[model samples]
Target: MPAESAPVGRRERNKQQKLERIVTAAAELFSERGVDEVTTQQIADAADIGTGTLFLYAKTKGELLLLVQNSHYADALERGRAASADARTPLDGVMALATPIIECNRVQVENGRTYLREMVFGDPTEPHHAAALAIVGETEQALAETLSRLASIPAAEASALARVVSSIMFLTMASSDAEVDIAQIVEGVRTQVSAILPR
Candidate 1:
C-alpha cells in the first residue's frame, strides 16, 4: 500500500479496536445487569475510555445495545447461511436460515426486545438504525439466494418468498409471549412457510 494509506488504515484499525472494547464491556454489563440498569459512565469506565468517547460511539443506551449486538447478529446470519447449505428442501433451508437468528435473540431477551423495538420505530437516520437494516438485508439476501438455488425459482420470486418468510420469523420472535417456547415459534414459521412455498 501507499504511504498515505498506511496511516488511514492504522487509524481505522485503532478505531475498530476501541469500538470492540466498548462493545465487549457493554455486552457483559447489559447481559449481567440488564439494559435498564447500566449507565454510560459505567460502560466507559469498563471500556477504559472517557465518557465523552463513549458518546462518540453511541448517543444513548439503546444505540449502545445495537452497537454491542450488531456483530453477534451478523455472525448468527452467517451461521444460518452456512447451515442452510446442508438443507434438503426449501422449507428446511428456510428453517436453517431462521433458527440461528432466533437463537441469537434468545441470548439477551430484554436487550433483543429493546433493539427490535428501536429498530422498528427509532430514528431512521441513526447509525444503529442503519446497522439494523444492514443485518436484516444480509439475512434476507442469504435466504433469497438459498431459496433461488434450492427451489429453482427466479431471484425476484425467491426474494419475495424470502420476505414472506422473514416477516413470519420476525413476528414469531417479536410478537410472541415471553413464556412462549422457541421451538413452538420456529414450528409456526415452518408451518407458515410450508403453506406458502411452492411444491
Candidate 2:
C-alpha cells in the first residue's frame, strides 16, 4: 500500500497559530491607527509572541501590512468580479469591478497607500510582496475580461487597456490627499476609464 501523508506535527501547528495571531493583531492595530502609527513591537506584544518570532513571520512593518492587506484585497477583487457580472455596458462593468477595490483601499487610507508603495518597491522575492503582486495581476485579468465585453476590443488590446485602467485606479488611490473622499476617487477613475474606452 502507498504510504499515507503525515499529519501536521506539533511544531508546525504552533507556528501556524502564531502566524494567525500576528496577522490578527496587526490587522486590528493597523485599522485602528494607520500603519504609520503602529510599531512591530506593539504587534508582537499584541500577538503574544516575542519580537523575534514576529520577525520570522514578517521582517518589517511593511511586510506585516502586506500580510494584513493582501487578504482584504483578494476579497475586494472577488466582490468586484461579482458586481461586474451584472453591468450592462463596458464602462459600467469596469466601474463595477473598480468600486469595491476602491472601497477596500479607502478603508484605511494611509495603510492602503502604504501597501501600494510597498508592493511597488518592496523586495519581490519576499512571499508577501509576491502575493500582493499576484493580486494585482488577477485584478488586471479581471478588468481585461470585462473590457473584452466590447466586441471591437480583442484580448491583447483589452489587456493593455486594463493595465492603463489599473494604473489610473492605483494612482488615484495612492496620490489623492487624505481628505479626498471615496466618491471623488471613484469618479476620477471613471472619467479616465471612459476616456480610454471606445464609444
The candidate maximizing lDDT is 2
Clash number for every model?
0, 0
TM-score, each model? 0.89, 0.96
TM-score between model 1 and native: 0.89
How would you encode candidate 2's per-residue C-alpha lDDT over 1-199 as one tens digit per residue? 9999999999999999999999999999999999999999999999999999999999999999999999999999999999999988999999999999999999989999999999999999999999999999999999999989843589999999999999999989999878999999999999999998888
Worst 10 residues of 1 by lDDT: 1-10
Lowest lDDT 10-residue stretch of candidate 2:
145-154
